[model samples]
Target: MTFRPVKATSEGQFTIEGAGVNLYRAFGFHKPREFDPFLLFDDFRNDDPKKFEKGFPWHPHRGIETITYVLDGEVEHGDSLGNKGVLGKGSVQWMTAGSGIMHQEMPRGNAAGQMHGFQLWANLPSSLKMTAPRYQDIQGSDIPEIIDDDGTKVKIVTGSFWGKRGPVDGIAADPLYLDVSVPPNTRKVLPVDTYANTFAYIFAGSASFRDASTPYGVRVEKEVNGEEVNIRDMSGNRTLVNFDTGNEIVVNSGPDGVRFLLISGQPIKEPVAWHGPIVMNTREELMQAFNELNNGTFIKDQRDH
Candidate 1:
């Protein structure tokens, strides 16, 4: 019954990628070891179509898996392996870029000209880095959603929770991806694997997560006599919360409630040699991958065994 304490909190930085898609990079590229088994997380929610319509052009990826979850728009994607599909609102597409593959993702805003979604990169172990590429496209209808009496809602995108299993499986990381929403001023505690590297990305409202817990009650406390509360303890939209090892997480939502993505996975704990979209165990292997691309043999099936 130990509750995980928040180790750190950070806000996303605005970055433009692909041909010209504006996004907020929550975490990636700098400290790989801190977020073991997970490499990058990007939020590409925008109201202006011009900022995101160009989308991510054809790109090559290997030694990792990309999970794209769309909430308010549609994303049309195609790969070099001839796999193609559309990820509409509430849809998810998990692509394993084992060995190598080239893909393109083009986004279109919804009727209100609003596009919202997230992309997460999960690292593959060395043994499965060269495995065959695959795809698991899950529609919103297939995902399991649970509603509690207190108005708390949880959508299990992957992994098991509340005696229900997710539709997508066979992933190397075996991560739990949950979209959780808590009623305003409510306090909730959720279980997590003790050993897994867990984090939460707040995208809707503010909340507080701390090691201090009162056995009596968990409620949103207001400042008395106009005394301001510490801002460091509060996490708002686009804020990332990294937690220490524990079996559960406790959160107290603000006056407006909170919604966030809670994700956790077993750590691979291997050395990472990363360069752009290509990630390998060693620098030599990374160079070889680039060389293969230059030689027109980057795709595994096209390369000579």
Candidate 2:
């Protein structure tokens, strides 16, 4: 197995969205193909209720799927189809806006006034863009966790990791999503599908993705030209590590250990014309969606098409 190297890294920036809720945006809204089959990812983690309690109000979505995973909070969600639910700690909700749908998510903190969670947007292919909408809600207990001999822990959310499969399924991208934690100073090599594009986002701690050329236990700094630059220093919290193609990933946990979300999927090599919350294959289709939305016909049941 070959270890995928980090090609690019990003420290998620602080952004406010959805009725004034403060959150960190990892990536979204531009350069769509880089995370193909996936559109956006946002992390909402805060200890102050004043920062997150406002929550997202009603919104429209079409031609994509939104996956919300809660770590320590409760999210009350309602959709135009009359579906409603609350996602509590460790729970996940996958909403498919195939044809079209309007929904709202309101977040509330725990008794301690702390909330943490993530929302990931995955794109649908043009063929399934206008299909019927649906939802798949997975309880916290339904998800599986795998523990390794080396003290590495993995929580599988989608696809097969190790020998265990995640609770959520029937996804078009066939993504592999894992919440992983490595023991301090331990090196763990995890397998990923060779054909899938992969990346990891560190949330809790720091770690180094395999720079195979560098021997383990050496300082993470790299020599560039004649100067020593700290390359792996960028792999800190809220850092997104974009990897090249490989069947496996090697992570060397720092002294404090490391926890991250390892996500991968097949790329959708199609043109993406996105506008606000709607995503289509072309600009004309995008304009049409906005037109229908403005004309009060954005809902699938109300559209003539």
Candidate 3:
């Protein structure tokens, strides 16, 4: 089994969104081709309520799907479709803004005034861009969590893993979203689909995703008697690792262990015409979407054929 190599790595950047929510953006806007079938990923995890209470006010989104996963607080959301709900700790909400939708998300911290979560925007192919909008809210209890014999824990948010399937299905991209935690000083190798684009976002602790021959912090490798030596440097918090084409991934956890989100999906391989929250196939289509929003015709009923 071939292991995927690290193509690039980043700690992302800090940004404020909505009315005034402080968050870290791992990737978005600048390069669409680099992460196909996925547009934006924001880590809105905060300890201070002041930085996240305002939350994401009413906004418009089209031609994309937004996946919000909460780990330590509550997120109350409402959309133009009259769908309203609250996402609690370990809960997930996947919303599909097929044609158009005005949405709002307000965060309420836990008892300790800690709010932590992530929001990922997935692009919809041109064929399904105008389809009816939908929502799949899965509670933390409903999602499957697997514990290995060696203390490795994995939460299957979407797609199948280790002979178990997640609760949410019928997604256009057929993505795999996993929350993984590896034991300290352990070496783990996970299998992945060779055809899918894969990446991992480390949120806690440190780990080495590259081979022992070429550890973290160093880009090049040196041959030590033509043998691969175990010299791994750990990648700490907020590290984003993008992998090259392969069917598996190798990870070596540090002393404190490591927790991260391992995500992958099939590439759409289409031209992206993006403008803020709206994404389309062509510039003309993008313009028309804004034009419709201005004329009060953006949101459509599911009955539209």
Runs of candidate 2 exceeding 4 Å displacement: 211-217, 220-234, 302-305
Residue 246's C-alpha lDDT in candidate 3? 93
Q: Model 2 over residues 69-106: C-alpha lDDT tens digits?
A: 99997999998988899999999998889889999999
Q: Which ten contiguous residues of candidate 3 have the minimum total lDDT?
A: 212-221
- In candidate 2, the residue pairs with backbone N, CA or C atoms under 3 Å apart (3 or more residues apart, or in different chains) clash, namely none
How do all models score by TM-score? 0.94, 0.93, 0.93
lDDT of 2 at 294: 92
Q: List the candidate numbers ranked by lDDT, top first.
A: 1, 3, 2
Total backbone collisions, model 1: 0
Q: Write the per-residue lDDT of candidate 1 for residues 1-305, one digit (tens) a residue.
A: 89898899999999999989999999999899899999999999999999999999999999999999999999999999888899999999999999999999999999999999999999999998898899999999999999988999999999999888788899999999999999887778889999999999999987887544542124445677897543334679999999999999988887789999999999999999999998899999899999999999889874312
Error of 2 at 46 (Å): 0.5
Model 1 TM-score (2 dp): 0.94
lDDT of each: 0.91, 0.88, 0.91
